[model samples]
Target: MARSLLPAPDARGPFSPGFWRSPLRGTWFTSVLGVVLLAGVTVLFVTGLLSYAAYNPDLSPVNDKTPDKGILGFYLFSWPTDPPWLYRLTQGVHVTLGLALVPVLLAKLWSVVPRLFTLPPARSLTHALERISLLLLVGGALFEFVTGILNVQLDYVFPGSFYPLHFYGAWVFFGAFLAHAVLKAPVAFRNLRRMREGGEERADGQADELAAPRPDPPTVSRRGALGLVGGGSLLLLATSAGRSFDGPLRQTAVLTPHGGPEPGGGPNGFQINKTAAYAGIRADETGEEAWRLAVTGRSGTVRLSRADLLGLPLHSAALPIACVEGWSTSDQWWRGVRLRDLAALVGHDGPVDVFVESLQRRGAFRHAALRANQVGDPRSLLALSVNGEELTPDHGHPARIIVPAAPGVLNTKWVARLTFGAL
Candidate 1:
């Protein structure tokens, strides 16, 4: 047959097999990284979904950041309050593991980067499909990791609201990730099995394109490269994991935001995501005389002043404030009327969904909703004080909602009104 009209496959630059010379760039090395990612990423995705459900996203319009989430949110459930530290654990793992896996993810990409430049892009229909999946997997992983780290650092340089973008991005990324994993898992497991069975080297006789045809002398052995990647992950874990704990370990959280000592000095002093000043809370509005909490429900509306709320039966619970940003306080001694009591004031003595409005004039979460379970949990409170001291303005002076196992924002600060019953 005569030569076709199509351009010859570009083999220059990265497309040339010679351009990749890393001796460690082989299927076994790549597969090992993939296997690690398979386990780690699965946990990350599950914890992430749990974090979303903890927001009670089913509340819709108010708590549902991804209203257009459609079938993606099918896994969401009424988040439980029994553990009290449930959200804390899930979110902490999500953020910390995501950070620690960065090194591994990078190494994995480096090992496979040559594939991105492969000439004659596809050899068959299946090859083309696999290529597409690979593209999405890499792109999705980078996008998710970068955006996640930015959020953890409290950096909002990225455009648009983080909630929807991250939420939707996760679904797309996970879809591609699962597809790629399904196709490659057998090869990865086989490579791992071979390594375990004492055939790590000089075993695979297959034509491995990942191996450089003219590789330079190895600077480090394959085992050394894996060690380097693992060590980097450990280093990251050491620097970032402490943000989830309280006390000296917190100092080790050098890479995470708000990992330092509690801001200011006192019982009430702890990490505050936003200050009253930042949230646009005027001194006059939150002052005892001016701030009256409006409670509306089956009994219609009734207003209560700070003193009035104080006069009602008071209770206390030790709960931590965990943020999506990853940092969390130790269990704080929180004192106030139980959320069920507040709901009771509105004639909702039983479990009932509650919509909470905040005095915050600027920023998201000025208002939030809690599922009936959250509202009814005996531990949930409209916190008036923390650690036996009245709340600081930054900690939601007049009043704040502190629900066990809820995301920090949903624990609406500077609370203004409570509406019980359906939204």
Candidate 2:
């Protein structure tokens, strides 16, 4: 009986309930969430780059004041559109994802608070540098999140232009992210390997060992406070996201006629006159015979002389020209005819793509091709006049292809020739 004594079973790893109670668990969760949050920021950054490349007025000085249209523009402004249900739903997801990050960031900060007491793993000159790097990263991340949220509210905190802050801050953030990654790479890799080899139990034990020792009486108070703060922040963010989903406030601008002497009627009412420019050509005066449109590519080569096009049925309509830069203007317009109709005149079959060339050929000549379905869209017009008057030279006078709801670049002003090809 005296020799029957035995030892008790071994205790569970550091990641057990006992271990998670320590401050280390909070730091771990925060670190993981930080990575996830950075991923979201990356997505927003890439989208901004694409928008800039697309000559988004919001980021461009040339047409920054112009009105914007198209799907990408709408997404940038977070505006509701014709597809009400679909728009709101997608926008809600975007806003919610953005806003949800706020609490996650806060929780991460809270978790990292206890790390101040503990010594960093590195003690060399390199380690000292790494510590400084981490501090800078934390500060930059905080600034990015704060400014980003303010941007969502349309509150421009920095003076001068929003572009400088948005664009320059991006590079700084990227540098910090890279530094953080380099510093944490080895530890992260080690932890991953240990987890993979030891399974859940070993991982849990490791977490427990890393956590701070709990004071007697089970110090659960901090956890409760964190839960409350995180919940409240999330709720606030969700409420804001809900409101944005309701749709943007509409503010209509008064219409003004900018051509020569205004027509007999006032701005409120207008009409389209076909005698004006169409396809950058007037009916009576024949331009250089050399000014023929050469259609090439998928439909084979077909040249349509100005006379040949004029013989086709001429149609005109007044439609709104909305630019992606947030400017909108309506024109009681005379256009050559429907683009789809013109395509038919040249025997344009299903597979043809369209590109319009301008006489000036200044700057970058805009080019776009429409899918078979997009060609027949009611809003597509080759405009000739605005408000019963000829278009001003600056406004793509003579003739411009106006695709309503498309970006201004795709509108193709001062069109002199047309070409068809595969997209």
The best candidate in terms of lDDT: 1
Number of clashes recorded per candidate = 0, 16
**How far out, in Å, is residue 259 in model 2?**
38
Q: What are the lDDT scores of the predictions, listed in order?
A: 0.86, 0.49
lDDT of 1 by residue, 1-423 (tens): 111234356567777889888888988889889989999999999999998888888885778778888889888888998798888899999989998899999999999887777657676788778788777788889889988998877788777888887878888899999898887899788877876786654366667757888998999999899999999999999988888877788888875688756577778667888999999999999887899999999999999999999999999999999998777888999999998988888788778998899989887789898989888889999999999899999999989999998999999998889999987
Q: Scored by Cα lDDT, where does model 2 land? A: 0.49
lDDT string, candidate 2, 345-382, tens digits: 56775544566666653433344444434356554666
Model 1 spans with C-alpha error above 4 angstroms: 1-10
Name the candidate that leads on TM-score.
1
**Weakest 10 consecutive residues of candidate 2 by summed lDDT:** 249-258
